[model samples]
Target chain A: MMNLSRRDTLRLGGVAIAALTIAPARARAETEALIKEFAGGKTPKNAGLTLDIPLAAENANAVPVTIRLDDRFSGARSCEEFLLVAERNPIPEACRFKFSPAMGMADVTTRIRLAESQTVVALARMSDGEILVRRVSVTVTVGGCNG
Target chain B: MLNRRTFIAAGAATVAAAPAIAAPVAVTSTTMLKPKGKKPRIVIAGGGWGGLSAARHLHAQGADAEVVVLERNPIFWSLPMSNKWLIDVLNTDYLLHDMIGPSRKYGYELVQTEVTGIERDKKIVRTSQGQIDYDFLIVAGGIRNGYDAWFGNDEKAIEFTRRAYPSGYTADAEHVAIKNKIHNFKGGTMVMTLPPPPHRCPPSPYERACVMAWYFKKNKIPAKIVILDPKPRIMPIGGGFKAAFDELYPDIIQHIPNAKVKEVDPFNKKIVTTAAEVKFDDAILMPPHQAADMVWRADLIGKTADGKPTTWAEIHPTMLHAKEDPNVYLVGDVMGAVSKQFGYYPKSAHVANYIGKIVAIYIAQRLKGQEVKTLLPDNLCYMMVSGEPKEAISVQFDYEIMPDGTISQKQIDIDIRSADLVEEDHKWAQRMYGDFLA
Candidate 1:
């Protein structure tokens, strides 16, 4: 048997589900499931994060996206980890970023692939066991994920 | 058992099994080479571009010597024209050739085994099969990508992420990994990174990015590729590639210099630099590279520009032999020969091919009790900038050996990136491949 890691299986599983009409409904369920996977089902507060991306991406490929933990909610003492998710991408969970005290700030910018127009979410975990959420809706005229 | 060439040409159904040998003693001097029934044997470690070139050059009709080549891989895959294949501009089959055929054709024995250890004093190469003694040794085993250089990036993480974003510099399978991503990508960011210099083919990352952008444009795929180069600006063929990026892929390709990938959060598909944290849909992360493992294991390393221990073998600039041992010669990407003309003799196929030829001549002459002549090898590199008809840029390197044994270097850029040079690049590949195989 081919060795497929959990992440790879999830990615492959996500694409396989896209073929069925259950996608749109399952996408919403998967988003919630992913948030729970990262946040452990804790109700996350909606504050302290600025998820900056284009409202309308001109190019589906190479859309510059940035997420920053504001000074008020910044520092390793306050913020422990960050996770980025595209609600509609074939693989909805983009990445999870962990920070240490050595890191002075919590700011990240990277381009991501998208399957269609969807809301991009950022979840920041607080040292006080609190999870904060920020979401931005972007219209991608051209879809980014073939799957 | 069928030779590796036949196996590879036969679709590499299976790799030839390693041969068993009894406890083997090391041969220390050339005198031991004159055995009762055998001739002097020259063993070339690494069946890469340089090793093959040396084997071909050393092959002479009725030469009173035995030549043997030891390569780890069962099949030979050329890295020169790989970018063209990745971007669907050329056939992928052209990238691979059978090494065993060439070695057998030129009367050299090709042993498909990994060289595990080397004892220079004893003139012995320890392979997975067994220990093989040699009169003269040429080490051209090439480079090992330094995935450790990136903070928080381990070899396992790099290997794990490679399935998603392949660093197609060494492994042929990585090309297929990235090629599939490119074809399957609906639209999204593709991240390609360039490690610091002293890597194989300095212009390759840029060339790959250019071809990728071309692929997006030609296929009408709404995609973008971001190139993160550690250097301050584009390197080696910088002007040519930059111009092509500006004129051809201004919208599709983004070149960001001095943006090193300091740390990678592979679990999240995120890369962190001092400036920003980058997320990618797909990526081709080229980690920093060093000389092959055996070179480091043998303690054949030198120093780099930053006074850090070099990942490459430091060798005599003119002689191509290891600075520490005269009998051991280092060629190709593994050598750390500094040159005034081309800084540290940029690791390119052309430069390695030239070094292999020169090293072969010097070693052959030395074996015959002839005075060895000082050598000055030229560096030639061609980079494909466009896909259709394949317009390319040509770079020529010239160097003069200073009286104090240092080199003074000069660079010449020929007729700008055009269709003519593409022909030249193709011809160069044909000639090099011919020299290696035919």
Candidate 2:
């Protein structure tokens, strides 16, 4: 038809506008504060965990996120707890999932609301007193949390 | 003189104001007001469920007020039973009605013209035909698709939203497309998305998913329905929807809560959510909804907590009249979610029909120069959860109008897929249609 490549760029531009308007600077700051509170000043190591989340999303309200712990890579007998965080949501903490030794694997999947294009962090706590972290960047084009 | 409590308890209410099981009655031409002075005219925009009810009720009350309805569609289609059409359980004849016959029989003038502008200062609606004056305006002009909210007024995005992913809320031609898509589906992922709350018929998406699941099962298709819900849990009917998924179609449908849609590429049939990017063989992508453009252009939209203008018209709960312009009344899905402060009422056709009657009584009383007391009509809803004719749930809500003018309702939870309620659902629809449209 018309110039296919130009049309594609225009389409991408539309999505970009949606992301920019949804997560302004103030929203990002709000999420950062929540992240600080959740961390409680403990330094999170970038090891022993994987955060599986979309790099970009069409809908802001329901983003699928998965957190998996690397039991073989680290010195952890068992996984105790896991936390999912959205860096710029009104409420940055998406959810908290607890795990027991009987479960064997510490993996959780759920949908979370994202205000804008921000980093999603997954934190996992091992029984051996180690905290592992992973971050994934997500760009949301349409907002779901319109009050 | 039936109060709110009695109205709710009596499932199918024929109150003092509205008589039930009545055939569609038209005001005789002899009874028409031929005033020595200017005749009082009531103009209802959007001749769908709510607008038609208000027009019919005004006629039934034997009011001297001249009633006129401005509807854009040539033939009337209902959002209520249209779902049955999508699953091939109901035909177009049942889904579509002759608007001309109803307008002529009811003695109300029906203009098959689009309402282009609302001239509030002059109390006239600027239509495609011409400017028509009115003494009172009833705005049942339903939802305007919130395409801007999703994709920043992108023409391609808006086009894709409307044509590619048919929401089937308006019962337009796209509804048939959705049905055809489902029927010809070759057994893969059928993605159905729900916008956040205050969308027309809260239980509809869940109902549609269950029905789609039934279609897949009945046809022996190897497909699954994935519902991406913007809310964290099942809303409005709540547990009833989840129970339907668990008991009837658990193997066929999977509901993911709090999964709001972020982006949709209709060209590629791809939808990206906060959770995952899903490619589907067929999809029903419902964008967020707003009141018709007339509500916004007339400066009738209210502000939300986020300081953004509301998607629907702001109206007083006691009488569904616009807060911005009292003479201009709003009903049906076009009315905002005032339930947060006023009371809990789902945006459904039945609730809208009830609101229309209440407005009619108020208008008639006012026309006679008599004071009309505040009224609280029960919000009644009957949702179909299965492809089978006899599987549905009926919800009834009663409210207490507080001294401050807000409503307080008692939560009545009923089990899902009740056969008795399903029978009531059919009877209720028939009587309701007979009461307003015959």
Candidate 3:
């Protein structure tokens, strides 16, 4: 029987916080370098940002991802921009989102295509000039024998 | 003790396809592997690819539980790498491993016994030796070749088909028989049939035809193999295999697609299918697949919450628990309900082995009173498509759960056969076998 319980799926959103605090594997260096370029020599720390994505995804072409900024950021001094990266994809920078202090809670939810199994990152430069980062590993697999 | 040589010889000598007739083990003698402490006792049924992986990981992760693996066979014979063995490319020794190596290495208990039944309410597993109580259980008994699908309660027909024409999925005897049949084949038409998808090793029948055709061409034997496939094209993976057949052994292989079998005359060596009727001098009729009998016996074969019966146990899509019994889990080739609803992970050794680890981690987390997070299991499969240059085709599968709870799939593959891929495949097998055994 199918467990298409929308409630269960909804509960899965915030539960991955602990497991998603990945240290970033070696393969993510390119994406990290790109983020570094975007930061212009500023260091990014894991703060006030949560990168939510399924740890294992069946559909590599379009995996749902969410990026939310925590209460640490006040509306008067919020991040002006956010960058999303899929490390293994040929084009690591999936997209960018522009924001302003008018938006109290800055959250970005979108779908991404992963090239293979690798890390996914969300980067933002807050109004205080601090680089906020959230990263998680999304295992992407393709090409297995059919069942 | 049965070594690889002895197991291979036993398989070769007795080609009657002896399925899981477990050598009865006495309970008194199995005490060495018995549970000693009050910790959660996790009894795993069928120490095949998945069971062994779960057992190994449970010990490796230091799960706070007593891991007891119940297997029917003392030695392991891997089915994945046996295609070459069938055509005498690789030695039979390559396919065998000792189950004791991993058990000892991981410090888990390995008990060789046949599981009779499961007492779900009591949390007990009845075996030929005795009943063992468990706090958590893993059902990894592999697949059942349903000859009934074709013969339909015709005991005489089913028995005859099994004896004369058998699939190489189970016992050593079946593999031996198929090997001998191919090796001693006289010049004529040879037939190989494929059941519907979600069966054992998706690209196997195609690969089998390829290897057999390769052998016939290598030896200059005047024979051809006709592939009676049920699927429209065996597409995706089959595309590469079909190309290999045309380019390499064009004269030796003839593939017939959309061949859904209607009737088979096993006694007369003829099969009638939706596509074309074929009579042959030699044939390998693989039975339609279902979960092992134990799955159905336990009432674990599930009907989804919305109410549709699945061929195998229905479990929590990610957590791998039986819908009816959270204490029980499903691993290996038996996650049919999930496979049916979502896209299926190929019912291969790699998936079984990978899923085993996931199941172990989930159970171990629960035992430790930690919030268990569900992880995905990936499959990396390589198939030997050519013999002379030792080339193979590889495929990998990854999954994501859709909003509707359907497990969506993404597949990346190289159907093109190459020598480097073969080497990599060997390395992968060696590493996996090492992880599983030692």
Number of the top-ranking candidate, with TM-score as the measure: 3
Model 3 Cα lDDT, one tens digit per residue, B1-438: 568656764663232111222233454422233333588789898889889999988987789887788888868988988888889888978988887767878878787777778879877777766667888999999888888778889999988888898877774578889999988987899888887766878327777888898899888899988988886565445557878989998888888889988999998999999999999998888877888877887778877578865677777877788987889988888876454434456788877887888888888888889998757766677788889988888766656555555565656656667898888778777878876776
Residue A35 displacement in candidate 2 (angstroms): 40
Q: In CAPRI terms, where does candidate 3 land?
A: incorrect
Model 1: lDDT of residue B72 = 83
Predicted candidate 2 versus true structure: per-residue lDDT over A1-147, tens digit per residue: 112232111111011111223355776776656556655677779987989876865344556678988663334488878878776666667788888787888877666767667888888777766677899988765312122
User: CA shift at B121, candidate 3, in angstroms?
Assistant: 1.1
Root-mean-square deviation of each candidate, in angstroms? 21.8, 14.8, 15.5
TM-score of chain B of 3: 0.89
For DockQ, the strongest prediction is 3
Rate residue B75 of model 1 by lDDT.
83
Q: Name the better of 1 and 2 by DockQ.
A: 2
Residue ranges of candidate 2 with Cα displaced over 4 Å: A1-147, B1-37, B342-344
What docking tier does model 1 reach?
incorrect
Over B207-257, each residue of candidate 2 has an lDDT whose tens digit, in order, gives 788778888888999998888887766655555778888888878898888
Worst 10 residues of 3 chain A by lDDT: A1-10
lDDT of 1 at B264: 78
Q: After superposition, how far is residue B196 of candidate 1 from its true place, in Å?
A: 0.8
